[model samples]
Target: MPTLSQQLLAKEAKYGASNYKPLDVMLCRGEGVWVWDLDGKRYLDCLSAYSAVNQGHCHPRILAALTEQASRLTLTSRAFHNDQLGLFYEELCTLTRSTRALPMNSGAEAVETALKVARKWAYQVKGVPADQAEIIVCDGNFHGRTLSVVSFSTDEPSRHGFGPFTSGFRIIPYGDADALEAAITRNTAAFLVEPIQGEAGVIIPPAGYLARARALCTEHDVLLILDEIQTGLGRTGALLAEEHEGIEADLTLIGKALSGGFYPVSAVLSHDAAMGVLKPGEHGSTFGGNPLACAVSRMALKVLVEEGMIENSARMGRRLQDGLAAIQTGVVREVRGRGLMIAIELDPAAGGARRFCEHLRDQGILCKETHTNTLRVTPPLVIDTDTVDWALDRFSRVLSAA
Candidate 1:
């Protein structure tokens, strides 16, 4: 008979879509920064479910909020009001320093919401002609996989066989302020970008790139939309990665950790000029602001701030980066990131990132590789110094052996 892991993998292969190439580890339970395999093997969680579990997995507070709210109310949709939605809005808006917010179920939905709102704002407020509005996007952006969101993608794997794509999107090289300035025209509606491109090997933009982009967007009257779904909610040692640049976007998208990995929750935060265009019946979601999600998200935010996870992320991130940098290995080409969202790029001559990732997995450390040769090493924000040291030791051993 097959082992539990093998049986599960076989079952998935037989029934599930062949969309993901997940590591062969079968994770059955997680808490804080550690996960257990089916046979009771332990591993440090380095990916944090792509930063969705920034507060760590199965947090007691978030779980309590989920259970409590679920017992009372779950879904009211947007057709009727729920008691928690208003408090969610108030708390979210106040925390993010935004005037308005629209809740959604996924990061992709938040991105879609932002796109629709930006186009509407362009037509109504910026005087752009209808159906002629163009939104500027950066290359290597991984906003989401939805059809409309994927329409502007420069990643070929995401775009191939998914067209004929939507129109009115312009692409520019990321971290190029001058390119952004040149791309703007009378019909440009918004400049959509990631503060630090998470999916593109954890690429950090040039210093002051966002500040310059913000200025250019302001001068050109184009809305600045920061896709913070991956980089927000204390993943980058701050409430939002935009804080590092000392700029605020006209529109901001956040998800992933919004519900502390207890639920699927995301939101589009907007200033008055952009979100004001949405009147009733224009847009909404069925499970967007459901009572359970709201209560869970509220507690998630509360715990993130009150528990000092952000500060711990900053301190541990520095330690992790320093430790990785000190590792003398021919395989590692570079180490770069902000807060817990770090990456180690391997030299192409040293095989690829997958081999190193597999080796680390064997040593009880869980991390995933992005692109071709870059290993993304984002542990949970709630990770401590000792765990960071343990993971770093494993990483050093793996790279040295490789």
Candidate 2:
């Protein structure tokens, strides 16, 4: 007979969709920056559910907020107001320094919502011809997996068999400010891009790239939409990755960690002119601003700040990155990132990142590979110096051996 883990794996292969190629470990519980498998073996979760658990797994305060508000009120839809909606709106806007916010359940919904908002803002505010507004996007962007989102995707695997593509989107080279300048037109309503290309192997742009992009967008009278779904809420050590360049996005889409992994919550933070274009009947989500989501998100944002997680991310990030840089350099091609979001591009002679990830998993460090040769290491923002040191040791050993 197969072992329990093997049996469970077989069951999943039989019943589940083959969409996700997750590692073989079967997680049963999580807390702080750690998780336990079915056999009670613990592993430090370096993935953090694609940076969705930045506050750490199952935080007590967020859990309390979730359960309490869940008992009181979960969904009121948009037909009537729930008590938590206004408070959620105020606190989110204040933290993000945005004029208005439109809530949605997931990052994709927010991306879709922002796209709609930009098109409408173009037609109404920018006076672009109806249905003719074009949005410029980067080549390697990973905003979401929606039909329209995949329309402009450069990843062939994601776009395979998923089109009849959406029009009105122009793809430009990432980190090339000149490309952005050349792509702009009066019909270009917005420049939708990620501050740092997270899913493209933690690919950060050249120095001053984003600042120049921001200036170009402003000069061209275009809205700058920063998809911060993977980079916001202290994942990049700052409150938002755009802070690294000292620029503000006209519309910032955030999700993932908005609820500390307790619930799905996302929003589009927009300027007054952009968000003002959305009238009542124009757009809505049934569970977008529900009371439970609002309450949990409020506390999630609270603990992330009050607990000094953002500060910790910056400090630990420097230590971790420096340590990784000091590792055995033969097998490593490059080590680059900001804050807790990091990646290691392995040299081709060392085989592939998948084997290194499997090796690290055996050492009780649960990391994931973003590409065939790139290992993405993003731990929870709540990670401490000691934990960073521990993770660095495992990474050094695994990559050195490779």
**Best by TM-score, which number?**
1
Cα TM-score of candidate 2:
0.98
Model 2, global lDDT = 0.93
Residue-pair clashes per prediction, in order, are 0, 0
The residue pairs found clashing in candidate 1 are none
lDDT (C-alpha) at residue 18 in model 1: 100
Candidate 1 stretches greater than 4 Å from native: none
Window of ten residues with lowest summed lDDT in model 1: 350-359
How much lDDT does each candidate structure score? 0.93, 0.93
TM-score of each: 0.99, 0.98
RMSD of each: 0.7, 1.0
CA lDDT, candidate 2, residue 396? 80
Runs in model 2 deviating more than 4 A are: none
Q: Residue 369, candidate 1: how far off, in angstroms?
A: 0.7
Candidate 1 on 174-234: residue-level lDDT in tens?
A: 9999999999999999999999999999999999999999999999999999999999999
